[model samples]
Target: MLTPLFERRIDRMNRGIAEGSLTARLPSGETRVLGGRAAGPAAVIELRSWRAMLRLALDGSSGWYAAWLAGEWASPDPVQLFALFTGNRAALAVEARAMGPSLLAKRVWHWLRRNHRSGSRRNIRFHYDLGNDFYEAWLDSRMNYSSAIFRGAESLEDAQAAKLRAMLERTATAPGDKILEIGCGWGPFVELAAREGRSVHGITLSTEQKAYAETRLSGHAGARFSLTDYRDVTGTYDAVASIEMAEAVGRRYWPDYLAAIARALKPGGHAALQFITYDDAMFEAYAANVDFIQRHVFPGGLLISESAFRALAAENGLLWQDQVNFGASYAETLRQWRERFDAAADADRLPAQFDAKFVDLWRYYLMYCEGGFRGGSIDVVQITLVKD
Candidate 1:
C-alpha cells in the first residue's frame, strides 16, 4: 500500500542504519533488510499497514507508538527494535524523531508543562499520584522507584537496597547528621537514614508519596516528610541526597536546582545525586523535540547533559566527584520491572481503574526506557557534589 514516495523514504531511513541489522516486513508483502554493515543487535519489525510508516514519518517515536496501539505494526522483540533505533539515532537523522506539525505541537505541549513551581506539582502528581497501591503491585518491597545497583545482588529488592546504601554512603553523613532528601519517593532512603539515628527531612510534591512516607516512618521521630519544592527549601543540612529527581527539573531550571543544592548544604557537605543523562552528542537533538517519555510517561522531564550539569555545579560552588555510571544495571532493572508488571496484570493485582490500554502503555514505556539504556545513548549515574 506504500506509494513510491513512501518507499523512497523507507529506503533512505534504511540506508542510514550503519551499525545494526533491521529486517523489516513491509505492508506490500515485501521484505527489506537494513543496516548489516557492522555488528550490532538484530531486530525485526513487521509493518501491518502503510499507516505505520506514515506515523513514523510524521510523528517519530510518539507516532510509532500510536501506530502500535492501533495495530499497524508488530515486533516480536520491541526492545531490540528500540535499541536499534536509539543506538543509530545519529545516523538515522530525523527518521525516528518528531517533525513538522507533530513536532511543533508536542513541543508546545511540553513547554506548557515545564517544571515551573506550579507546573512541577501537576507534573509530579500526574505520574506519581497514580496511587501507591498501583506502584506497590509491581515495585519491589521498600518501594524504591529509581534504578537499583545490581552488583552482587540476587534479587530486585536486594539490588534496590544496595543502591540505597550506596547513595547513603555517598552522602557521608554520620549519626545525628541532618540530611535533606529532595524528591523523596516513598521514604526508603529517609527511613534508612532515620533508622541510623540521623535527622532526615524528605520533600516531595506528590500527596500520595508524602502520605505513604509519613505513615511508613511514623515510628521514627527523626524522619519528616513534607510537600515542598526544591526552590523553597529552608535551612542548611549536613548532607543531601536526591535520587533520580533532578531529571524533573527542566533545562531552564538547572542553575536553580544546583543553586538550591549549594545553598542547602553546609560548607564541605556532600550532596549525592542519582540522575539520568543524555550523551553530549545526543542532547541537542533530544532537547530540540519532545520525546515519548516527555510527551507521555513523565511530562516536563528532561535528561541532563552531564557536561553542562557538571559545569553548572561548578559554577554553583559544588564540585562534582565520585561519579559512577550504571546504565546497564538500569536496563536490567527495567526488564525486571516490566516482568513484575506483567505478572501483576495477569494476577489482576493492578488497580481496576487502569485498563488494558493503560497497561499496554506502561509496558511499552518500560521497554522504551530499557532499550534506551541498552543502546548506550542514555545513561544513569550516581555522583557526589561537594559544596565548596
Candidate 2:
C-alpha cells in the first residue's frame, strides 16, 4: 500500500526524493524504504502497518497525527521526523485534497463546550488541569505555559522571567497599582507582580490552576486568585493583562472578551496581551479547517490576525501602542521542552505510556508547532494597547 502511495507522493514532489528516502520499520519489525530525499539528518519511522499508511494517504496531516498518537509510528528523534514533513509541506499542501476529518475528531471537537462561562471552565480544565506535576516536569519554575522572550541563548528559566519582566515594564504597573490578569495560568505573572508590591486579581477558568495558585499566593498581601471566567469578574482594575489566553475565547466570543477587558479597566487604563497569530491570507483557510491543533491541542480556540486585533483595539478605544514579534523564540522553547519530555520516561516524571503513544504524540505536536513558526505559518506577538 505504501509502495503505491509513496510512489505517487514522491512522483508529485519530483525532487529526486528517492535519493533521500526514509527507512521505515513496520510493526512486524520489517524495514522498507519511504519518502523522497529528506532535507536534513537521517531518521527512522516505526511504522504501524500497511493500513496505517493507507490512512496516512487518505487522511492528510491529521491522519499522521492520529497515527502517531495511537502509537502507530515513531522516530527516535521527532525533530528529524517532523523535519521530513515540513521540508515537503509545500509540495504536500499543494496536493492535499479536501479530505474530511480522518477519525471524526472534528465532530467531537464541534460538540465540546465553547466560550461561555461553563464552556470556558471545561475547556480550561481539559488542558491545564491535566496535573500540576505533569506540567512542572516540563515547564519553567513559575509554570509558564506560554512563549518566553529570549535574550540570546539564555536558559528557559531565565527567558521566562524576562518574559514576565517585560510584560511588567510594558504595562507600567506601579508599586501599588491594581491589576487584573485574565486567564492567568497558575498565577506566575500575578505572583511576580505581587512580589513587587502591586495588587493583582487573577482570574482563571481551570479549577486546578486556581487551586494551585491559591495555595502559592495566599500569603501575599495584594494577591488574589479566582476560579472564574473573564466575563464574570466584577471589579475595575488599573490595568489588564492576558497572555495567550485570547485564543480560547473563540471567534463567537471575541467581542465579549475584548469588552470584558475593557470593562475591567479603570479610566486611562492599559492592556498587555500576548497571542498566537496567523497571516491575513490564511485567515479564511484557518476559519474553515478544524486542523490538527484545533482537534487535538486547543479545542474551541481560534487564532486572530494581528490586523484584526489592531482594528478591534481601535474600535474599543484602545490605541495600539506597541507590538513585538518573537516567534522564533517559541521554536527554540519547544526544542527545550522536547528535550525535557524526551527524558521524562527515564526520569520517571512522565513515564512512557504502555503503548509509548504519549511521548511520540507529544514530540510530534511540539515539532509540528515549531514547523509552523519556522515556516511563518504562525507567529507570536505581545501588543500593548492604551486607553487614554
Candidate 3:
C-alpha cells in the first residue's frame, strides 16, 4: 500500500501543477521540468522529493504547522498554537491572503495599544506582575535576566555574575552616591548597590516586582524601589543602570526612555543599558515572526537599527561611552535556560500551564534564536552612556 507521505507528495505536486511549473535545474545546466501548463507569471519552485518536503515542512517551518500537518511535532499547551503558527511562512501567506497588510497591521496595532503604554502602570503590571518565583525558576538566583557577559568565563553562572560585575564597574558605583535603575527586575542591582553603601532608587512598572523588591530591600537603608514608570521619573542620579529590561521598552519609546534617563541623571553621571535587538535591515525574512513576538511575547517592542539608537542618544544629550555585543553569550544563556527548564519540568511541582508551555516554547525559542544568531539577524548590545 502507498504510504501517507507518498500521497502528500503527490498532492503537493498536483497543487504545484495547478498553480505553476515546478522544475529542477542540475548543476551541469541540465533542466527537468514538470507542470500541467504554462500560465502567466509562472511560479517556479525546485522539484523536491516527498521525504525532503516532509523534512523541510516539519523542521524548517514552524512547529505549530508541523504539528497540524504531520502530527509529529510537540506542544505542551493548546494556547501555544498562536506563537508556533506565526513562525510558519506558509500560514502567514494564507493570513495575508485573507486579510490585507493594512488590516493585519491594524490588528497588531490594537494589540500594541493594549499592552505597550510607555510609562503606564497597566503596561508594566501586565508583564512584570508575573510572580517573582516563576522568573527565579529560570533566571539566576540574583534574578539577572539580561544577557550574560561571557568574556573569559567557563560557565553561564560565572559569566552572568561577571556581566553584573561588569555593569557595576562600568557605572562606577561609589559610596553614598545616588543611583537610578530603570526596569529594575527583582532589584538585584538595587540590593547590590545598597550593600556597597550607595543610595539607590529603582523604578519598575510591575507592582509584583516592586512588592518583592520592597520586601528584599526593607532592612537595607538608602535603597528604594518605586512602583512607577521609567519615563515619568524625575530626579538627578549620579549613576543609572537597566539590565536586560530594554526589550520591554518598545522602539518608539527609545527616545523617550533615553530622554528620561538623561533628565534623571546628573551631569557626568553614568548610565548602563543592556538589551537584545535585531538589526532592522535584516528583518524582511522574519517579518512574520517579528509580528508574532510583538503580539505574544512583548507588545510594542521594536527592534531598531544600530544607527537609530546612536541618533536617538545624540538627540537626548547622552554620549555613548562604551558598547559591547553579547550575542554569543545570549545563545549560551538561552541554552542554559532551556536545559534548566527541561530538567525541572515535573508535572507535580510546576503549574500545569508552565509545564504545558515549556517544551514547545523553549524549543521554538531556542532553535529559532540559534538560527537567527548564526544568520546575524539578531544582536545583544550593552551600551554605557554619560550625560553630556
- In model 3, the worst 10-residue window by lDDT is 78-87
The better-scoring model by TM-score among 2 and 3 is 2
* lDDT for each residue of candidate 2 in 1-388, tens digit (9 for 90 to 100): 3466655553454552332445667666667666555344355778766555555666656676776666677777655555554444544443322255543555466456566777777777777777787787888788898999887988999998988988877777799999999989999999999999889988887878888899988888899987777777788888898999988888778877888888887878889898988766656655655666666666778887778777877877788877899988887888888788768756778733324665655667888887666656578989887875
Q: Give a tens-digit lDDT track for model 1, residues 170-230.
A: 9999999999999999999999999998999999999999999999899997999999999
Superposition error at 206 for model 1 (Å): 0.4
> How should the candidates be ordered by TM-score, best one leading?
1, 2, 3
Clashing pairs in 3: none
- Pairs with steric clashes in candidate 2: 17-36, 17-37, 20-37
Q: Please estimate how well model 3 matches the true structure, expressed as its whole-model Cα lDDT.
A: 0.62
For residues 1-388, could you state the per-residue lDDT of candidate 3 as single tens digits? 3346545544454444432343443223445554446442232332223433344333333322333334443323322222222222232323211134533564566455543455356555555566676676667777776667777656777887788778777787689899898888888888878888989898887878888889878999988988777767886889899887766666556777888889988888899888776656544343333343454345555565677777898898889877888777776776677666555564243444654554455445555554344334478888888888
lDDT at position 255, candidate 1: 96
By TM-score, the best candidate is 1
In model 1, state the lDDT of residue 324.
97
**Once model 2 is optimally superposed onto the true structure by TM-score, how far is the C-alpha of residue 190 displaced, in angstroms?**
0.6
- Residue 180, model 3, lDDT: 90
